[model samples]
Target: VPKGVILTHHNFISNVRTCVAMFDITSRDTVLSFLPLSHVLERMVMFAYLYAGTTIAFAESIEAVAQNLIEIKPNIMVSVPRVFEKIYARVMDNILNSSSLKRRIFFWAYRVGKKYAARQLQGEKIPASLKLKRQIAHKLVFSKIIERTGGRVRFFISGGAPLAKDIAEFFYAIGLIIYEGYGLTETAPVLAVNRPGALKFGSVGRPIPEVEIKFAPDGEILARGPNVMKGYYKKEAETREAFEGGWFHTGDIGYLDEDGFLVITDRKKDIIVTSGGKNVAPQAIENLLKTSSYISTVVVLGDRRKFLSALVVPNFEKLETLAREKGWHYTERKELINKPETVDLIKSEIDRACTGLASYERVKRIALLDHDFEIEKGEITPTLKVRRTAIENRYRELIDSLYREESSVSSDDFPSEESK
Candidate 1:
């Protein structure tokens, strides 16, 4: 439905006030603003910074965030999960491509750091031996990773999408905390956020005092708060639908955990129900795949189908590096992606990432997309979230072929019922 949301000054003010207090933003903090200013999250965050008298630094572009981070030395930054994913991917790429000794050392440090972080997150006291090991891990590996973020970052705020749990843990293990939050433009935009000393890796934290969050029987998160808009512009039907049952309907499906923290699974509409009567979260699978350094973007699709498949955009830079190492001739992107070696590489990555996934949830096959989902192509939103229906429709032929008998991806190829 086409609708312009009407938000008042009071809505912005109340939300901003709560967020500022939660994050403890003050004049001493510097924020690197790179996400589109028109985005509700960025704009609302801008207001919060102004309220806190914080210093705001604008990057020349998203591509320049790394250089800008060094130049600005921002203490606090906010971004969507996409930015963090890229950062994680880049770091992993470098580590994986390094020498055998260096790789082993990095992994050892990572293990130690992760163990330390897990203990800290559980509110358990760290033993003297583990504390010493953590310090060594920071000096040898974590310090170098932190240096890329300007070494002054106190923490980062991730919203707009769910940060991959592994990525969150990796950063936290290295002493860079990502406090993931959950909200929407319709709610002026924040209902819950993880604050210092109350953060959880996967959960979005307890609901803020400013807003109330409940759920429908099916687990669609619902809210009715002063920050929520009264109605949509010129769309009475849509507005009524949004405010069905007297609550602002957030189409996101999630649940409150035992500790009162919010955990968003996936969007209600994005849930894929396969022919096997399995309800799979596409975003969960997509996020899991994106954790691989070789994959840049992926869209999982199996809605009303036999099993899961995906359209994957390979990280060409990493692919080219692999090609160079393998002595495989690769000049053009299309030609390189067509090679059997590349396909096998991606297949292995998918299989590796889908290790713990159930048979119904595992993506059995994927079509290698030469290009990524783009805003100009209407395949992605301004916030870079994939427009699933649009992409599925645009690539209908390719998708259909994946399901055809000739292209019937073997049940033995991946983790499936037949494999066991």
Candidate 2:
């Protein structure tokens, strides 16, 4: 628990150099900085920006980033997935509430843009007719999306969490690519990152030039390189345990795919093993659920239980709008979500979202909370990652009630294998 991660000068310099070469950062580029510099990932990227003599402008606050984007017109930036998630939800919510004709046109352009992007990613030949259609699609839809981001974004570098594949592809269809990366505090915070042109949608990309990686017997990721931390600052015993056979134990569980790209399953300690002995990764389910505009956040909760369930936080702003339109009356958020109609609506949405998942992985029941998991309340980390143990402890009673229903959720609530 006390293994200190001390990054050496060489480690910091090497990571910065790798990023500079990978992105071809130059004096001409301007970066809008928002992530805290206390985070090693932002620290290294900031160093690289200074090394290349690129201009750095700090965002006044997280809420002000949108206005800053327009005012400064940054050429490149680094961010976590939450920013993208918010933008995606807002854009989708507007479309969902728009006129039928506009909705149809937007979706048509979306499909055409996705096809064009797919061809470009694969280096496949594009027929002239398809190219002509793509041009029309951009003129009508994609260009407007880019304008919302100040129309000068080159690309974004995302990390600190897993980015959903569909969200990454959505950006690509609109001509903005989010190149994702992966690492931990012990590895000077960057071990692998996707390159600009050679992008893989869900992967965190290959190892950096100076690092060597391998998987353990239990599938824990292991690394050895100049970039790896020296050792625990004062705890020799913990340091020894972290480094066995000269390889730093990452404590993260993942494996490289056939293409040598890292596919993180989940944290080694976070995988939930059901009572039936089936192993399930909660992050996969949570990512899919978060795509719903009504669901702002979710935590999968079926560890050692007969079936899966969820602790959900709804988008209150959207819910209020719906309540207004429906002429529903409520004085409290909790009372609002407890209505029979609201529960039915959320259940249907969950069923539709989980249609593609296996039976054992789909959420069987859910408890919708009026408020989100807040960092100040100790439910999440400063970086916004959920503190699972704390959240579980805080919501113990709510979670227990989900398992107390007399009957298991009906099959009709979750799609069958054939229906998928």
Candidate 3:
């Protein structure tokens, strides 16, 4: 699809109509579309572009997004949270790896900008002291960074995953309004989006016009609006299960704030309750762990138990690089993990990540695995989601050994312990 064209199934034309009417896009607008046409988000956006007579430039592939963005110099770009995270990480890495004075100045400017942005978002009138500092930071640091966003992007929208509050604020402070929205493939994928001048941090903004959002008794988000899909394709039973009464029952667990903003807590199915009667959301802990470059995968465990623990799979490549820099000899993954010094280093890193978590949700002990869990190993889904049940079963022995203080040696050294 190229400028002024739409690519989508006819069944979803209604959603396209809604988007076109809502965004008020025009022929002058250019959209660099690349998300799969089959997906509701891409389809809806593409159709909306056509309805507005807007120009659409399709990227060759996901890898070509940067080059395409530069070529297209799009006015709007919509992407999943993962894409934004990668860009943020790469930018931060570059800043950190710069010269000492540049790194310090970059961080100093970031802090000043963040404070100003936070105050503005909270509706606290900016003080003169902060206002002046923010102006300097914007000109000297933030503006240059924003220019790298193809120099023409006016709005950046994030969906699919929870956008970290810090990342959102950082971008906003730097003059980019990264609007976080909430929806699913079932709901034409755009129930609520933050509009210009009406944005809110932390919460997904108010429901879009014509969209009705409400909460279920169990905190599941429900929607009743024109954007709602007709039903599942050729699956009446499944479709019926999706809607209760008149609202589409979104399986995600979340709540609408007093101001009518949506705040997702976790998935209802992903909540874990410990034996001590403490409820924990593993996703929160997992998200924190992933902030560390060393930690590639983390599964927090304490369900029906006294305390939380974890099974971690380190990013071996990053760890090897660090080990070499620190003058440590690295051999096998297990050997590196079992090293007392390395284990302590990981413990400290995990502790830092879990600093703000509730005591019950904090990981008390960690066991590093030799390899990452993957779908091929029957430990993950094809979509790269963790197969919690399979992982728990496979690591049952190691988990049990971690809880047993009587064991003097590592679980791998004891056949009985390893066999479980």
Candidate 4:
């Protein structure tokens, strides 16, 4: 295995400089730093803040980030999609669980706010009636969401993991911007970032200054830049493989869209080549499923199998609330998760998420689990990334059972769509 990458002083400084320039971070800006300093992404951003003479407030812990955001009133921050996802889920849960009048008002205001923001982005002229409606919407609903962050956040620089488009849109709808980007530890962690004024929902923006990126024959991203690391420590063979033909092999499959923004499909090694020869990217499907408030964690499986299936971990709190409303009875956690109604609830969510996806990309079967993939269980990495091999090994029986049951059929087998 590759032990570690050798990043030099120049690489760090180059990344920090490029990052600060991207955001135009200034001394007036206050950044909330919650991610561990040991991680290259955080470390680079921290140094960039320092380089720009920006104020950095350390968060107490990962769990305390929400509270810290209000107290710090940060002008800019770095975060992964999980943070945004949790916030989105909480907001949706609150609105959905509220009174009928309040729910209607909240949703109505949300639409107006989104329309206003979209129009603003397009530089379209706003009519007086629409302007007044937007102002009312902002005061009635969007203001409360903004107040959660202490109302001063300019933007959130997101990376580490792919940010779901729906989650990004939710933030934008509330007048908050989440700028999603892409990179790995080996690339000093910031190869490309969505700049302040030019943000796209899904695509990671153009490469930073001095970085040259290209796609390989198989669509793997290859790069040659000052930000790239020298080599892996004491692993000559691995280093050679990493830097073959004078380019650093990123091991990520992606392409430059029409506008030259980088769009990551999935990890090269994680691509699932189904028995039918269709190459599917699990991350996209997994990200889509995780958009549902009920879903907490999802692992898509089917490398050499017939079709894709998933192991889903539901947000137990939301599920319990639903169970109460539906009058479902269960004594223990396992009993609750194994109940027929509970399974059907998860099935409905999976089906909704799979609606617009390609037939092969849709999850044919899913096993609902009460527990999340935990790092201590060796099912996930310390960074909270699911270890695919470890998960497959640990849940071998459950996964086999999903495929074994003839009852697990494609989304097409379900009844025609009805209004939600």
lDDT (CA) for every model shown? 0.87, 0.85, 0.74, 0.84
| Model 2 poorest ten-residue lDDT run | 411-420
Higher-scoring candidate on TM-score, 1 or 4:
1
How do all models score by TM-score?
Answer: 0.95, 0.94, 0.80, 0.93
Q: Residue 245 deviation, candidate 3, in Å?
A: 2.5
Clashing pairs in 3: 3-56, 275-304, 275-305
For candidate 2, give the lDDT of residue 223: 93
Q: Worst lDDT window (10 residues) for model 1?
A: 411-420
RMSD to true structure for each model, in Å: 3.4, 4.0, 5.6, 3.9
The lDDT of model 3 is 0.74
**Model 4: per-residue lDDT, tens digit, 192-254?**
878876677789888888999998999999998998999998888999999999999999999
Please list all clashing residue pairs in model 1, or write none if there are none: none
- In model 4, the worst 10-residue window by lDDT is 411-420
Output candidate 4 Cα RMSD.
3.9
Off by over 4 Å in 2: 1-3, 405-420
Cα lDDT of model 2 by residue, 1-420, tens digit: 324678898988889888899889999998999988888888889999999999999999988998898888888989988888888999999998999998998999999989999999999999999899889888988888888877888899999888999999999997888999999888888988898766888888888888899999999999988788888798788889989988999888888888888878888888989998989989888889889888888899889998898888878888889989998888988777877667777777788889889888999878888788997899976567888899999988777776665265553342211111
Q: In model 2, how large is the Cα lDDT of residue 411?
A: 35
Q: Best candidate per TM-score, number?
A: 1
| Tens digit of per-residue lDDT, candidate 3, span 4-39 | 112235435656665566556678888788777755
